[model samples]
Target: MALQVGLVGLPNVGKSTLFNAVSQAGAEAANFPFCTIDPNVGVVAVPDERLTRLAELAASKKVVPTAIEFVDIAGLVAGASKGEGLGNQFLAHIREVDAICNVVRCFDDDDIVHVSGSVDPARDVEIITTELVLADLATVEKRLDRANRTARTGDKDAIRERDVIEALRDHLGDGRVARTFPGELPPAVARELSLLTAKPVLYAANVAEDDLGQGGEARGNPYVEVVRKLAEEEGAEVVVISAQVESELAELAGDERQEYLDDLGLDRSGLERLIDRAYQLLGLLTYFTAGPQEARAWTVPSGSTAPRAAREIHTDFERGFIKAEVIAYDDYDRLGSEAAARDAGRLRIEGKEYVVADGDVIHFRFNV
Candidate 1:
């Protein structure tokens, strides 16, 4: 499955605007609140200059880039946990995502209505975080209730589960996420109780165009400070992007786009940085399968074993396990060809235990 990220925030925070800019899928972006009724799901090809360069060097006909899935869920409200404004339904969508891109409205636009009647990003973030925490607390309470029932019957495993639930409940009660409970949670417990706040989050500060390169140091943007502080505490990643500006940049021609970015003193699009940050948050790595017929990039988690990565290609390849012939893209490029790389001892035959690295060019040998 592709790494899924949920774009969540209060209404009118430019979540759909950022979504449209990054995915190039036209999701409705209106001035009214709650315009995005249903979730907009789009698969965005992760941009890697190395993959593009490899494709060019290989002279392959088809160039396939690895992709990540972004889900633009409805804007969450203050009482979302209590069934307010598409509440539980949207929270349910969040539970399915692997990570989150919390888009906070840092820009000021009188035309765009703020759901809270004012542009206060800190308050908005608190409201959304509170909802997630409340929802998680509710889940923890239910699990604790069930575990308590089983513990009364002298189930050792259930008693342990009850203890964990109590700890989690304490944390959630203090407005902290259950993920901060300080230990490795059992997979069974994690699977049974999908904690919304447990997912990794990247704060997307939807700033004004002038503040883009300020790195959140610009004055008058209270939300940037809030997000920066949160990121510092959680060791999370934060990125600044002007969704309105990016949307306009997306509509321009190639040279015109470059000129606009250059004028803004940016070397690349904010959308690219956002996507790259999402990939890093998910710990995703890319590997290429190159040949005359087709050249494609595949995405996998960083620590994925060779066999597991093979399954990403085909189940048959994984079932019929064999060694993988691997060459680093850099080495391949320097050596010019596979034969030259092998002769120079740059290619390696790795076993199933080998963890695939990013930028590896791999050829798998398998029997059906």
Candidate 2:
């Protein structure tokens, strides 16, 4: 399954607009709250120039890029945890995603209405985060009763899980996210809890087109700076984009799109940057398989084992695991061919224990 990043923010913060730009999917971008009742899902190919070059070198007929799934969830509001503003449904969508893209309003447009009646990035972030925290708190508290019961029966695993739940409840009570719960949580407990706040987040600061240049730079516009500071405190990443501009760009194709971006003095659109950041937020890596048939990119976790990566290609490959003939992308590109890379001793024969690296050109050798 493609890893997904869920778009979340208060109503009318351009989440749908940004989603439309990134995926080119026509999600409803209305100006009112609860406009997007159902989550809009779109799969976008991850842009990697290396895959194109590799396909050319291998004379492959097709080049397929790995994809990321973007889910446009409805806007979140205050008291969402308590079933306000379709909060229950929205929160469920968030729980289904691998990461969160929190779209915050940084532009001032009197024409569009703000749910809170003002454009305050920091305040808006607080409102959304507090609700997520509260929702998680409710989840933890509910589990605590059952966990406490099991722990009382003297099950060692149950005791450990109950203790972790207690710590999580305390962390949420203090207005802190599960991501900042001080120490590493056990895998069992972490999987069981699946707290919304524990998921990685990237902040998309929705700015006006005039403020685009100022949005991403180190010293950005004051509104972006406010969001930057908040992200800094939480160890999250921020990408600034003009949803209106992206919406416009999404309508054009080919050279026209390039011309539009060029006219704006941008090498690439902010939506592209946001997509890359969203991919990174999940700590995902891409490896390649190139041949005369096809050159394709496959997604895996950063430190996935060779066998695990083979499973991404096919369960049979992993079932009958053997060695992998791996070549680093740069080595293959520099050497000009896999044959030359082999002669130069740039190819490696790795076993199942080998941890796959990003940009690796792999040829799995398996027997089923």
Candidate 3:
């Protein structure tokens, strides 16, 4: 399963709208705050053209794409850690996610209200981040006291763990996210804390349709500039999109949507861009399995070895491991067929330790 990313922002910043567009989950996109009191979870296919090409070449009857989960969380307000504006519940929902998508309102619509009475992307981001830091600080503080007590008993492991907690405490005390915690924490100690701020985050700037193309390398939207500057400081990524426009496009079918996107001077949908960016942010890669019956895309960490990638398909595959017959997607595409690629000696026999590359086609040779 693909890792989940939580969508969070002040209410009415298009979190639900974006969620509905990407996942087609039909999350309620009301204008009022806390409209999404309960978290809405949706799974979306990770857009990959390679899977389609593989299916065609293999004469596969079915194609299955890898998927990612998105959770639409209610808006957060100041004093969230202190139980304001359903903050505790929202924060609890956030704890289960692997990463965060902080939606910042960049468009101005008189009909829609901003949570802070004005649109300030930087201030909004600061508010949400500060809340996360404060929440983590509280959690770390509770852990620190017990760790110190255990260290006082002359336990070496406890002493090391306590020192790690102390370093994290210092970082949180300075109102910084756990991802920026400078010291290297031991694996056990890090898992023991599980601080919320430790999760990677990306800023989603919801712009007007007119400003849709003014982000990333081409800077046109002033609000996107503010978000970009803040993201640079935090070492995070920024995905600029018009959620309202994408939501509208989501209602249309393939050709209709493509036509609309073309009319907007776009080659692809913003949802695709956002999904691709999130996939990269999480350090994810895709590999494929092709056969006469099915062609499927699988997601794995960037440097995953052959056995590990096989385990994603089935534990039996990993337990009864053997060599993997692999071919690069490029070779298959250029050769026009798997038979041609094999004749060209492009198909390779990869052992257990062979690291799977993105767009690799693998046929697992397992005894199980």
Candidate 4:
């Protein structure tokens, strides 16, 4: 399954605009609030120049890039936890995602309405955070109640579970997110208590065209400062992008796009940075399968075992476990071919215990 990320923010923060620009899925982007009533899902291919080069080296007939899923949920209101302005429904959509791309509007456009009536990223963050906290508090409370009932039966595990849930409830009650907890909770416990704010966050600072290379301050935007501080405290990542600029950049032809970005004094598209950050946030790594038939990239968690990585390709591959022929992308690029790399002792045969690395070119040897 593709790693899922939810785009969330107050109304008119360009959540849908950034979604359309990244996914090219033509999601509704209007000046009105709550334009995206239903969640807009788009599967975007992760861009990798290394994949293209590997495909060229292998002389493959088809090249497949790995993809990530982006979900553009409806605008979240201040009282979304209480079902205000499609709030509960949207928060449900957010709960289903693995991570969040919090779109904080750092741009100013009188034509584009701000749902909060002003641009205050700190206040916007508070509103959204509070709603998520409220939603999580309700979820944790229900779970705690159920666990409390189960605890009376003298199930020691249930008592421990109740203790954790109550602790989480207290934290959420204090306007803190579940992710702020000190240690990792069991997956079962986490699944039972759907915590909205616990998901990893990537702050997308929506800036204007002039602010492309200006470190998000050309417009003297306040959200830039607020997001920076929040990210610092949470040890999260942030990327500043001009949605309007990227929308226009997406329309240009290949060479023209580079020229346009150069004209704007930008090194690369904010959309690219956003995608890269999302990929990293998921702890995902890409491995390549190169052959004459196809050269493809596959996404796997960073520490995925060989068998687990094979399962991502096909269940049969995992079931029929065998050693894998692996070569780092850099070795292939330097040594020119698989045979040459093998002859030079750069290629390796790894077992099931081998943990896959990012940018690894793997050829699985399996018999089904």
- The positional error of residue 255 in candidate 2, measured at the CA in angstroms, is 3.0
Best by TM-score: 3
Model 4 lDDT-worst window of ten = 212-221
Model 2, 180-268: lDDT tens per residue? 89866678767777889999999999888877763244245788899999999989999878888988987898999988887777877
Q: Rank the candidates by lDDT, best first.
A: 2, 3, 4, 1
Model 1 C-alpha RMSD to native = 1.8
Report how far off residue 340 is in candidate 3 (Å).
1.8
Q: Candidate 1: where are CA atoms >4 Å away?
A: 214-222
lDDT for 204 in candidate 4 is 89
TM-score against native, each model: 0.95, 0.95, 0.97, 0.96
**Can you give the lDDT of residue 125 in candidate 1?**
79
On TM-score, the stronger of 3 and 4 is 3
Candidate 2: worst 10 consecutive residues by lDDT?
212-221
Model 1 TM-score, all chains together: 0.95
lDDT (Cα, tens digit) per residue for candidate 3, span 1-368? 56899999988788889999888998888889998899999998877888988899899999999988999999999999988997999998998888999999988898999888989888899899999889889888998998999999998988988898898899899887889777888887677667788998988999888777623222677888999999998789988888878888878988898788877778777778877888889898999999899999999989999999999999999999889999999999899787898899999999998999999999898997
lDDT of 4 by residue, 58-176 (tens): 99999999988999998888889999997989998998899988899987789888987988888887788899999988988888888899989998888777787788888889988
Clashes of 2: 0
User: Better model by TM-score, 1 or 4?
Assistant: 4
Which TM-score value belongs to model 2? Answer: 0.95
Q: Rate the local accuracy (lDDT) of all candidates.
A: 0.86, 0.89, 0.88, 0.86
